[model samples]
Target: MKQGQHKQTDPDPAAHVSAGSLQGYKGLTPALLTKLAKLGISNMQGLLLHMPLRYVDETRITAVRDLRSGEQAQVQGEVVHVEVQYRPRKVLICRLNDQSGQLVLRFLHFYPSQLASLKEGKQIRALGEVRSGFFGWEMVHPQYRVVGDETEVATALTPVYPTTAGLSQAVIRKWIAWALSHADLSDTLPASVSQSLNLPSFAQSLACLHHPAPEADLASLESREHPAWQRLAFEELLAQQLSMRRHYARRKHQGAPALKPSKTLITALLKSLPFALTQAQQKVALEIGRDLEKPYPMQRLLQGDVGSGKTIVAAMAAMQAIEQGWQAAIMAPTEILAEQHYQKMQGWLAPLGIQVAWLAGSQGKKQRREMLAAIADGQAQLVIGTHALFQEQVVFQRLALAIVDEQHRFGVQQRLSLRQKGGQPHQLMMSATPIPRTLSMSYFADLDVSVIDELPPGRTPIVTRLISDARRDEVLERVQDACMQGRQAYWVCPLIEESEALQLQTVTDTYETLQQSFPHLKVGLVHGRMKPAEKQTVMAAFSAGETQLLVATTVIEVGVDVPNASLMVIEHAERMGLSQLHQLRGRVGRGAAKSSCILLYQDGKLSEMARARLKTIYESTDGFVIAQADLAQRGPGEFMGIRQSGVPMLKIADLERDHELLEAARELAERWLETEPVLVDKHLARWLGHAEELVKV
Candidate 1:
């Protein structure tokens, strides 16, 4: 037997064992238990083993004579009067009387059926946490039972679990009770494994978790000091580390033919640039050149904040690939972004007579066929487009490099498809999101990272201002002035159309309003619901200055670039994440003209978190600082919907508190993989299994 477990044998094992298990509760009705497996609960054992999020200590009971202020207690007393308090909301108030004192039992939103259950002048037992008010003692939603049924009044510390709206504490407790009664007490782990780790068996742990007989039993079940959680956490980290290592190893085996850029050609390209590159940019270029010289393909990430000249750096890398007599391709996530990159590349690389062709979803069939032929025949030296570049028909002759824009948007399979073309191409993934160095190292350790921290010359810092609705007219006047100056402007709305729940201002409504405000100006609209061709047409008009003002959704956040656009207005800016806001602001400040971003927010009802986010935006335009602050304000998991990013999901390893643990785990994982490639040892194997389960991969 485990050291601190209950030693007493059941007086009547038959009485202890009950019938209604979770398996039994599955009565052909679709309830939480029916859908439990999808959320990782597999069996009755798994359901009962799910621990409570917190515990409520409803164990304190006292007589009316001993009742004190600011104490939580259950008391038995006679009822005096039942009345209803009607003010902000309806509440049921029952005044109780005892030998020495009186107290009020309050229930928020109590129904008539509840009042019918209790009779005045009848003895009753009240179980509630006490709060001292100005008039007297009050307990809200206190558990009540008949005076004679004292056993039913829960006097022990009760478990309170994380629950959905339809599930309540009583229902969960009943389910747990059912599970405990039907346990089979079978051990899943091998005896040798359990002996080595000195861990409890599967059945034993489950039983203890449901009905902990002692404090030690509860602690052991919680796995707070036990080796179970550590074992689990380690296992999760190891699986990710191993998966990354395997991917890296596989890439290395692809065999990249060594190709070095000609010194004279690279020197000529660098000298011909309009301005000298920043030191940080030069450092990154050198790294890329060095990687190209190696026989192994380069897999690197280029991360920079908004307006950090990342496109220029990418162009230089493509130039090097051209010098090596091999073709290069750049893939953007959207056609708009691809078109933007194509235009930028044409303006910059066309002077050198380097042929560049764009192939996207909207390309003409005959034109696409011709471009594909030129690419396969080694005529087009550089190709830039959306996913069209990765299609099976579009082949590359000796493709040497691939540049992926907005790397997060493309999945691993999509990126691999491009690299696998003709030959495994050297990869450079770029993101405008500035990830913290440590997180980047921990999350993307498999890939090398280069950051651009400097902005190019003549780029003006965008002034961000927060305005209340009272200043709506003033904001509109400013936008009107910016548009009248021959410079274009973008007005971003939160939603495409109206919805019942959100009440947010829609882009269509905003477009109509703005058109009336500026009668002579042409207004173009684009949203996710618009057809691709329609979107392209509107975007093209905006780019060519046919529409001086454009109203758009978040779709334009990443790639539609118009250098002359000097004004950006984002409505309900507080609703956006910091990274999203940064990307939106990046749309402007691409030109020599001064740009200004105005954030319009509702008055008087902003949440604390929303206010903080807006304040952070106003304080600085530094993306790195904003990223760090975002992590601190909302932990990495919640910074931007943890499900979307690959950041490790942790229960106890707080990103803020346990950063040290994260670093330690990273070093341990890397060393273990480097030394012991396979998880040969029993300890490491066990750890790997636990890690994989925790990450839910």
Candidate 2:
């Protein structure tokens, strides 16, 4: 057979056997199979994929006398004595002696069968952390296996697997070995591709990883950089890239309304703007314009830093839809953001005789009825709302474009539902949280990305300061001084209500305190728990400058743009995510005046992770750098909110460490898709368990 090609032979009967069949295997019981199911090992393939987290080096057994104080070692000796002591927490002590010296095996908890197995004069192989004990050098809870007189002592690394309470490493390894022996171990990748990449066959990689030779580099295996690990990671990344490329290709075949370039409304709106569009904004707007003009539906991600004027670019795209005699809709994650978009859209388009409608879940029956009717009749040229716009009852006359703001907050299904509402309308997703390059390439392979890398000129740079909470009084006094200077400020709390468990400051308590401190000044509050109308009212007051200070939760993190607000003080800033803190800081520095952000962390010792987060924020103002740091700290899943961002779950690939493999896989996938589209399904099936579900995103 070839290097990657599978042999053409009859399928092995064991290929069809499920993991539950393992109950018939030599040690596993029915109850144990049920326990294994909880770990997602339901079939033979699942068991194979449950790779070891790490390995124990038992290649060379060490003598008992040669053991160090704090080193993990493996030793083989004859059991000299075994006893169960009642005192000192019901201890079970077994002493083993070799030619060099004697070692004690202390088991704080053990079964009667374990005592029987460790009988006197039984030769046992023990592996564990060696530590100094009261008696002598000992190993607590060491993994020991009895050896018979004729049994061979192999010099091979031991695989340590992730297990639940009822399962043991020995049992898991035994079952895995049984499954591997019976498995057909077919080659998944084609010979040509594998040879070009110099990657091992799927079966070969699995075998090497499961049973690494003693000569294998231990450091490479531990760091997951061995050839076997690299092969698996590359295959996983290639599968994802293939799925995304298929999705991208499939969308190209779907028909959409080809919107023409806006000549009248867009020209007038641009002219009417108080300031000129930045070069970056103009470039992105043109990219979006070209995408809108295509017959195929446009799936593009518009990424810009906070206060980078992404909203205007979206407005320009919406205008293209309206000018072509079709309605446009913009969806935000929250009501405050939706209302903010609504107000901005109305201000820009209402003057051009465009009808803008607002539809949120909190709208009254009569108001919603009017808005729905206008949308259906095509009278509302542009509509701005939250997820409520995608409701079944809310029908659009002809939605030519659907722009989703902060797209990560919405799930793939929710966004797809909106697209299905209007015969595959052109979609534009916007994110103010600038995604790192590696993440954008992997997570958003299906969409064409346009980045607004430059901020619009004339915006003031915000000065970031990390202050301990012990200086709360000093910070509060500074806030008062800023308010007295006729400037606005935002005092953000992490929680809306005081949690006795967390002991963090609450928005309500902070509002009251600020209110009392500045009795003459107006204070506004907004949070997720507030009614939509009430929240809108408070936000309106804040924007109108009716309130000099807004004490609220992170609900004001995005979409509440007040250029005059020059001060941002986040209490318990350590509790907030890095991206969120950047967004909150972005609220200021929007105006010409100099701005300052005070990160008030709790006094005393903070975790190393928290301190790192604060230090990263303080050292950099670049969103891309901060995003990379956040990805490093929180990982791809949490940083992008995996489910919401529609990032496919990678089983083996690490986006941070395996970036080179990802790049190679992307190139190979693209080349394969271009040259041989017919084999794509086979490639996907071999690696991707749910390619169909991932493509829908």
User: How well is each residue in 456-515 modelled by candidate 1, as lDDT tens digits?
Assistant: 778888988899867889988988898889999999988876887867889999999999
| Model 2 residue 591 CA deviation in Å | 0.9
Cα deviation of 417 in candidate 1 (Å)?
A: 4.1
Count of clashing residue pairs in every prediction: 3, 0
Model number with the top TM-score: 2
Q: Scored by Cα lDDT, where does model 1 land?
A: 0.71
User: Could you give candidate 2's per-residue lDDT for residues 354-389 as a string of tens digits?
Assistant: 999999999999999999999999999898999998
lDDT, each prediction: 0.71, 0.86
Q: How many backbone clashes does candidate 2 have?
A: 0
Q: TM-score for all predictions? A: 0.74, 0.92
